[model samples]
Target: MCSSSSSRTIPAALAIFLALLLHWSSAQLSPSFYDMTCPGLSDIVLDVVLQAQISDPRMPASLIRLHFHDCFVDGCDASVLLDNSDTIVSEKDAVPNAKSARGFDVIDAIKSAVEEACLGVVSCADILALAAEAALGRRDSTTANMSGANNLPGPVDTLAVLQSKFAAVGLDDTDLVTLSGKEP
Candidate 1:
């Protein structure tokens, strides 16, 4: 009983759905990603985060914010950590990140320590994710500037605005609520 146009539409819809599903599947993150290569990675990160907190009590909060910002802008990649160069525009200079983001030095120190212990093993991206866990197990994006900063909602933003920002990064209402409760 199906018309020809309806039949063609169904196939096209299925193709698009499959394409999207594949893309999402490929983007998954796994805790076991570093199990074999760097068993001590989490401990290393937690130690560093704790040490940094000693000097700067804000370190933990800043790290949590930094990780969230990085994820929103670029799927949790450490692209946010890259400094500007002749061939690259750093995400740090981006509007949302400009003077707002901190804890890079802490991340650098952590990276150095991790590298010393397990060289060529862990990635800054994964470190960022794991760092969040260590801080929370203890605690706790991009370069588009206008678009990037705009993507991170401000403190005075309404619930709707906050929801929009979270949604922009593929997070849902529940995620937004969860994030809002993570502050000190």
Candidate 2:
């Protein structure tokens, strides 16, 4: 009799324990709750991160792949969000000091904002992908609006010509878009 009663009580106790643990750990939670559409906070942060890395060449290609995987596999569920787990972000390391740049600064600003709001909630992997996508989009849009190849980075402009302008903005053509999250 005692064994039977304890077995039934154990399940109930375990359920309550799990519920409380989930609640306590979720104190900070996130801006966008997980759902089918998009992970709101994660998406926004990733966008900012991709924008940040547009001009950075040192970033690894594998990191870029992970960004898309996170977004596409789960529609920005924030699961792809890897912590890169580094307490210290190396954003300041790769940039050159003398050059005049606009986009890198924007990227930095975005990173800062996310840190303020979500900090550990996001991962370096997601941030990198986000920054890349934003940079790519900006460059693409600029080219589309251009009149000709000879003009200021118009779509018709040669690939090399566009790169020069991208340097000014701290971005490149290849840095944009992830395979999955663009639509979601």
Instruction: List clash counts for every candidate, in order.
Output: 6, 8
Local accuracy of candidate 2 as per-residue lDDT tens digits, 1-184: 2256655753454443333223223333332332223345556655654554565432323333333233222222223332222442221121221121124344346557767767555444334435433111100010111111112233344556556544443333432111111111
Q: For candidate 2, give the lDDT.
A: 0.35
lDDT of 2 at 105: 44
Best by lDDT: 1
Residue 163's lDDT within candidate 2 is 60
TM-score of each: 0.68, 0.24
Whole-model Cα lDDT of every candidate shown, in order: 0.65, 0.35
RMSD of each: 15.3, 21.7
Query: lDDT, candidate 2, residue 126?
Result: 32
The C-alpha stretches of model 2 lying farther than 4 A from their native spots are 1-38, 42-102, 134-184
Off by over 4 Å in 1: 1-28, 134-146, 158-163, 180-184
TM-score of 2: 0.24
